[model samples]
Target: GREAEGDIQKGQKEKEEKEKGREDQEAAAGASLGEEAPCSRGALLSPSRKAWNPGPAESKLELHPLLNRWALWFFKNDHSRTWQDNLQLVTKFDTVEDFWAMYSNIQLASKLSSGCDYALFKDGIEPMWEDSRNKRGGRWLVSLAKQQRHSELDHLWLETLLCLIGESFEEHSREVCGAVINIRTKRDKIAVWTREAENQEGVLHIGRVYKERLGLSTKTVIGYQAHADTASKSSSLAKNKFVV
Candidate 1:
């Protein structure tokens, strides 16, 4: 769940670039930029269609495929509409080249207006807590200071996305559902949502891999918060169930 934002002024919630910017976030100990992300994996193999062809020669380009299909969702905090109504599906991709095409084309996280969000979830799962796959799960939350929004937000967000499509968690990847980035007026946040909160070994392993993949420096810590706890709270902040 999220804090009540209906009272937030409309002017403040306007998107940075309606056709460009929007995504979501939080802070953590430290992390890498994941420059070497293997974005090869995506979802189902697309059916051959002339509409997908770029041109005569390049049309035959073999795209690197991902292990799973993923969907990108966008949310605009609108006081007039229900939260569910504001969420929209942007697109779906399952190939490395396609993912990059989409990524490069979209607005960077830092450019999004306040209250806008971007969620990259496995094809079948929604990025909200009510989904069956996420109901009992929790997220590895990373909170970012306001200043870091301009400096680290884009790099960290890209790394987090790479970690997802690249399947960085090894055996624990199956337990992962999706990730969300919230661009708020105050502190920004990025969270990786998993299917189970009680899977200690798996959850902790994911946290470690995430931190390592992001190339986080030692000393700082990131926390994990269950969806149930977050949903029931009246505030955006939730108690940490685990930390790494």
Candidate 2:
């Protein structure tokens, strides 16, 4: 028993060390992200040696990897194209620096033309209501007024991105599958999609943390609607399963 306890302690220590190293790498990347190429997914994945150098023994470039590989999807409601064809995979990134690099290069949420959306989902999960990972899940939806688009849309979307990549939901992080921001003509929306809408506790916890991260007004209320619900009915008609 004592030997087993020692082994567990050693494992925990190793985990802590690994986490520390990851943070250090992310910090280094943040400091030098300005040098990265714009619109280069390759740069996001394979940062050049000129941008990072941790030590003589290590590789010329090392980046801080995230817990989950995420793919960014862009959707423009192109009337000429089918929905699937309209949605394009912009890029995928699994490192803090890559996320920052790609994000910096892209247009802000407020700047996206109406009927366009930006979605970041874990690799292998499609950013659609019909996606297997999303079909059973729901989203905590934050609807913004037309005016708020100019004032608050970009900031809130950035915060939502940071929350997902940072895993800010703690024990409920895995429940969060992805997030989306839609730019519309009159009203805009941002939603954090979770894996299981039936997991009331986990879903609610994510809602609370997400709302807090967005720095929403305490009087404001947001709603969570399952994909099953939203898929069957128009979003305006879907009933909220939960709210925060």
Candidate 3:
């Protein structure tokens, strides 16, 4: 029994070390981007990395409210279920603290099974292109190689979500509809869906700001595709209306 306990403890220590290493890597990436990570407050770490125990039950903690209330939706690709049935509304939050709390409690994007997706959008907006707000719009799509899912996917996804809730696009934020992360076996994608594809100024501005916020290299191009086009064809075959 004592020997078994020793092995279990050693395994726990190794797991802790791996978690710490992941956190360090994310921090370094954020530093290179000239910004602090959205999870820097230890919000994104695995449960083993830190004990996230709350204080007194009646404790009053001040919450920083966001300009918009956002809804989080999860889609698990289950052939047994209808498309709508597979999509579930996880929760909605309007405060920064609440967002962090929700994020800390959920499984990280990178950990989601292939074909799953996580979407964050303004409270009333559904994630589908069929939504009235999204019908006439387009998306700024960033495709990631399968190799990047392990090292870069989670960080990029969180940054995208923060950009949405943080209003990182300044005045163009009004054009923002939401962001989606699609997990795939071959390659993954993240897209910021906006309300008007015809509003070139707003769309381009969002694209520029989003790319920079993701710390993507200037040479690494991202494309904006209209919902109309994407609806008619596979994403791979859809032509980009704008690139940044």
Candidate 4:
């Protein structure tokens, strides 16, 4: 009986020691896991769990805001659709970067099909002459030859846009409504539309500034035609209300 009891006591002690060994190994494994590098844990995490790291501040471009928010309109000639239906509002942009981004991505004025037009008007105003802000206004007409479409058209149009967004007109900038580039088979026309036709001083100043910016020769005379005269005219023979 005494011998049997000794054997049982030894077996019980061995079992307890094995259990202690297993517990110690488990505790050590947990400690090792806690001490592991962050990279190891990051690998197990989902993509969304990771923090967002923005690009370097110095490399990011700060966009320049323009004086006025402008809306760009494209008019495609369609026999089936009315004139109003053909005009589409492409987008409105208030920043210089955004404007260039849009301009660079779209077809150039010279590239648009004939009878089409590109109009840049102040936000909330339609490009039509009938718009309340434009009904009494006139445009400083720049008639471009067919040959000049490829060479000078784009440059002149870009300068016109820069003049507008840059507010190059100074005090008379308010008188300016927008500009239009009409692509035609016979001749492409560019014009700076102003808010008032009766204000002779403002009209002449805008025309002179526009012509100079366009790098037009002194001999090249551009005329201003009132919306009323244009609306009444049956053909291209609208009488010039003011000439510069």
Candidate 5:
């Protein structure tokens, strides 16, 4: 409850400041302040904090630091509303504890109805083809048969989210954009999107790490497809550029 309250407070403060900054920039010839202020970045990004402690009560909880802040989004399909309108921001967190709190409180991916999607992306990056961060990226897709939806969907989705937030890929982790779980009628799909399609080495490394983390069988095959291809061709017919 405390963690959830802290997240709500943080989100509200950030939203208000963003709105105010936008208005101020519009009045000041359209040059907006960057997302991370200089002083804040210096404090947040510094390596010195690794050794700092906030004393006893805080020390009781082991703080797991993440490489980046991530935003969780939910898309509830509605025939009466546009796609963008149905997509809503749930919350954002940069720590392992907060992530677990949010994940445990929300409905599992398996419980979501067909046409719904859960996307976890880097903060400030929207989970869509239109977002500049995702425009050039591609996804490593794991398609599940309809029969597997009830049994494996939720587990796989949670594993994927943990892999991303935990920086499990080591050096190649920086190339990861986010992961998505799309609930569909015929099949449910889980994909991990990376920022560059052309970086074959990094892409493959990420894929290997992802597959290993999920404990996927050697018989199972997953494909990687560039966003450019998915954007032009229908998703159902999109060709795979790489497979492992």
Candidate 6:
């Protein structure tokens, strides 16, 4: 017991020493004779007793701000349960760092099981067709073959996300609602949904920008379909209102 207590004390001392070293570095970075440098409260307090507080230069990581906060949803298919029951909210993130952190931790789009789906929508909006913000919207669909998943799914998904966060659609960016990636047995689908399907200029612009960003071949045809049509269709087919 005494040895264990001694070990604990040694660990605490080492921790305190490391902390003091960090504070000293911060102080050296923050100290400037004629200039005010930014320092955290802890850094400032740590070296108050020292005659010379030389804080280490602040190594602040500049985080890029996204145009909007996005929520990521995951749907794991369960034949015994309703579709709504299978859909679950994974997480919501607003900053660039948080987005990447979440993205890196999750299973890659290509690796997900068939019948699963990943949806990223602006905060406060659900990814379902019935959501008020999405009811009037339509998605620019990019259907990828099963083979493409191994080669292109993850890259395409990242591009779609960048388009959303970067506001790459120009003036039409405001019309953008979110994006979705559906993992299916036959084909994997990636779609960027916008708020108004009827906004021809915005919809087409979003589609062109999206398709170009994904580097889709000219021979590859992508379609845009209204949610209304998608919702009412009995078959898995919906009429394409526009194509690019």
Q: Pick the candidate with the highest lDDT.
A: 3
TM-scores for all candidates: the values are 0.76, 0.77, 0.78, 0.75, 0.75, 0.74
* Candidate 3 residue runs with Cα over 4 Å from true position: 1-59
Q: Which of candidates 2 and 3 is the stronger one according to lDDT?
A: 3
Task: Give the distance in Å from residue 49's predicted Cα in candidate 5 to where it truly belongs.
Answer: 26
Clashing pairs in 5: none
* lDDT of candidate 1 over 1-244, digit per residue (tens): 0111112222222322211221111012122213221112222111111012222222233456677899999999999999999999999998765776678678898999999999999999988889999999999988888899999898888889878877778778989999999999889999999999999999999999998877788787988998889888933567899999
Could you tell me which 10 consecutive residues in candidate 5 have the lowest summed lDDT?
Answer: 1-10
Write down the lDDT of every candidate, Cα atoms only. Answer: 0.74, 0.77, 0.78, 0.74, 0.75, 0.74
Candidate 6 global CA lDDT score? 0.74
Model 3, range 36-58, lDDT digits (tens) per residue? 22223222222223213223320
Q: Please list all clashing residue pairs in model 2, or write none if there are none.
A: none
**Model 4: per-residue lDDT, tens digit, 1-244?**
1111111122444444434454354354332222321122122121222222212321142334566899999999999999999999999998654665566667989899999999999998899988999999989889989999999998888888777766777788889999999999999999899999999998888888888988899998889999888888832799888777
Off by over 4 Å in 5: 1-62
Q: Each model's number of backbone clashes? A: 29, 0, 0, 0, 0, 13
Q: What is the lDDT of residue 23 in candidate 3?
A: 48
The TM-score measured for candidate 3 stands at 0.78
Alpha-carbon runs more than 4 Å astray in model 1: 1-59, 234-237
Cα displacement (angstroms), candidate 6, residue 175, comes to 0.8
Give each prediction's root-mean-square deviation over alpha carbons. Answer: 14.8, 8.7, 12.3, 25.4, 13.9, 14.5
TM-score ranking, high to low? 3, 2, 1, 4, 5, 6
| Candidate 6 TM-score over all chains jointly | 0.74
Q: Which lDDT tens digits does candidate 2 get at residues 1-244?
A: 1111121122444445444455466565553434322222233333232244232212233455677899999999999999999999999998766686688678888989999999999999999888888889999999999999889888888888878876778878889899999999989999999999999999999999888888898999999999999988989999999988
